[model samples]
Target: YYQEEFAIRRTLISCLDWCDILRIWDVDALL
Candidate 1:
């Protein structure tokens, strides 16, 4: 159970990180 929760949390964090990276790229492209 604990391992499953940890995996979910890690996946969520990576998804958020990817979003942030994409946002930054979008801003850079606009500039």
Candidate 2:
């Protein structure tokens, strides 16, 4: 559900530093 996704995104943002977040997106683009 949308709420579940929002919670997951919030947790991910809290857990990862900004640079780590960019790295994750970069890796996803590579895949």
Candidate 3:
């Protein structure tokens, strides 16, 4: 159970990181 929880947390963090990168790219494209 602990390992599963850790994996889920890591996946969430990675997804958030990707979202931030995409947002930055979108802003740069608009400019």
lDDT of each: 1.00, 0.90, 1.00
Residue 6 accuracy (lDDT) in model 3 = 100
Candidate 1 regions with alpha-carbon error over 4 angstroms: none
Model 2: per-residue Cα lDDT over 1-31, one tens digit each: 9999999999888777777888999999999
Each model's Cα RMSD: 0.3, 8.1, 0.3
Residue pairs of candidate 3 with colliding backbone atoms: none
Predicted candidate 3 versus true structure: per-residue lDDT over 1-31, tens digit per residue? 9999999999999999999999999999999
Clashing pairs in 2: none
Number of the predicted model whose TM-score against the real structure is largest: 1
List pairs with backbone clashes in candidate 1: none
Q: After TM-score superposition, what is the CA distance of residue 11 in candidate 1 from its true location, in Å?
A: 0.1
Which is the better candidate, 1 or 2, if ranked by TM-score?
1
**lDDT (Cα, tens digit) per residue for candidate 1, span 1-31:** 9999999999999999999999999999999
Q: Give the 10-residue window scoring lowest on summed lDDT in candidate 2.
A: 12-21
* TM agreement with the true structure for every prediction: 0.96, 0.50, 0.96
